[model samples]
Target: MSTYRLFDRRFIRHLAVLVSATVLCFSAAAQNVLRVATEGTYPPWSFKDAQGQLQGWDVDIANAICEKLKMKCEIAAQDWDGIIPGLLAQKYDAIVASMAITEERKKRVDFTNKYKSTISRFVAHKGTSPDVSPGALKGKTIGVQRGSIQAGYLTANYKDSDVKFYDTPQAAELDLVAGRVDYILGNMVTYYVGFMKRPEAKDFEFIGPNLQGGLLGDGNGIAVRKNSPELLAKLNGALAAIMADGTYDRITAKYFPFKLM
Candidate 1:
């Protein structure tokens, strides 16, 4: 070939190699397995079953969403205390565990449009003089799960009250049953699964208006890395599709008495 023709052919070959590399990079990204982190102790959101298998609303929903995305999903159980930091460190692709979207957390991560709403509920002893009213528990101590919406709510709204933070609802419930705390504060769904379902739960009752919106967050959404714009877009779109098709409502109904999604 002529010298000019040889130069053009080499340029075309180099360009082709560049294009192939780009395509391969894109394909690798598309096929990446999504890692979802959650606090497995939170019932109705994500909790271990009696057999020690991970089962709950968030688990089911995550599987469905992954199915829709046609991507493999790996659910990892992380301590609630470290969930946020772990996500920030890129330990997971998203947190599907009933994590609310809050301004404080938005600084560290992005969230999908809220797919569900949960009210913080208070469980108190039946016929107890002090009920679950926010004001009633002012002097009385209340047990709440640490690093949860219940603890956040109590700290923000009932600063004057004695708020006892426990590591988990199970621990908080023990204190509540032992009369160490007058009441227990947590999400309604968690209360239902962990406490309300127990035979001994008959001694307790849920009370107070559903605390909604604002500092509690617009509701629960999928949490993602702050810079994961493409992943966030894909997840948000998947959520929108599920919500629009009533799949979200169906899943909600299966696990909750009321429509949380």
Candidate 2:
């Protein structure tokens, strides 16, 4: 071969190798691996099944978002109180635990547009007809999930009532069933699915008006660190895609009879 031709061929081979390596590097970087946090105790939203596997609306939604983004996702079970702190400390890339978009949380972490809207309600024994007004509920013990919007609402509006908080809604429901509380304040969907639908809850019914707005904020959204604008954008895009593609509705139908979005 001519000397010039031999050098040109060798240069082409080197360039091809470098280009392949660069493409592989970019591919690896593009494969986003995200660790998502959730309160595995919240049923219909996120919870553990009989086999100890994580499953629920929130888990399904997170998986769907990952699928839409063509990325790898890991769901990490974290305590509700620590979920936000964990995200702030880089323990998780995002939170999809049905966390409401409240002003207090906005001060700490940025939130994507709400994936689901929610409202709180008061539940009491059937035919009891307990007054729901702040004055009427005075000195009455109310059960609510700690750190939830119901707790905040009760604290802010029902000052005369004694509010007892539990780590999980199940515990508060237990208290209500045991007659330890006059009423249980919680999400309407949760009350309907987790309590009112159960055989044990047949004697109970929802009372008062649906409580929302103000301290409850707008709705439930995925939480991301304030500094992760790119991640936030990606999540928002994925959420929109799922909602538009009917995936969101399918998942909602699996857990709820009524629309939450």
Candidate 3:
């Protein structure tokens, strides 16, 4: 072959190898990064502070998992209703939004083993206890966050009652304070810490039996898209590691007095 042609061929081969190496590097970097989504309005679990930084138990859990896996993570705030859709749409790689492991949810997405077991209950103005049973709930107005497990439970069981659906938990709380709703059903910790702990909630107290089992779900779990077994396995392993090393408990203590996991 002519020397000119030989030189050109070698140059082309070198360029191809360089391009391939660059692409491989980018893929590896992407694999090392974990993108997480949380409902920023949900306090003590995940919420944005005054400076808009994400904080709370769910945020801590996500950070710990990322640390144990040696993966850098980017957490973004999302609406509670959009969290699952965002994960499936690749807006984020996983959800650490205090979502429960319910059978209905299982059909849409796979979940890491539960990180926290939560109980649901009713909260109302103190001194006026209301029965939460289906029969007692008839003609009452119950406020709940839309697309939450408590919302689903109210829909399924309390058809006789007026269900006030709010896009955010804070909205439902505001209505409860205004006495627009008879009562609100949700996570006990969220009510006590996120809402009722405030001075405005001094008159409100938890009432009715602690709701769990059946439709309430197993517990809160990190959600990832279905068929992501490798990523799922990595997260679950990291979760187990954090719990064993006391990282999980320490984070919990900062936000909650008792163990959630």
> Which candidate wins on TM-score?
3
Ranking by TM-score: 3, 2, 1
- C-alpha TM-score for every candidate: 0.84, 0.87, 0.92
Regions of model 3 farther than 4 Å from truth: 1-19
Report, for every candidate in turn, its global Cα lDDT versus the true structure: 0.83, 0.90, 0.90
Worst 10 residues of 2 by lDDT: 26-35
- Kindly list the per-residue Cα lDDT of model 2 for residues 63-119, writing each as its tens digit: 999999998889989988788889999898899999989998899999999999988
* Per-residue alpha-carbon lDDT of candidate 3 for residues 100-142, written as tens digits (9 for 90 to 100): 8999999999999988897998988897655678898789999
Angstrom error at residue 70, model 3: 0.7
Ranking by lDDT: 3, 2, 1
Model 1 misplacement above 4 A: 1-30, 129-135
How close to the true structure is residue 253 of candidate 2, measured as C-alpha lDDT? 93
In lDDT terms, how accurate is model 3? 0.90
Error of 3 at 28 (Å): 0.3
List residue ranges in candidate 2 displaced over 4 A. 1-31
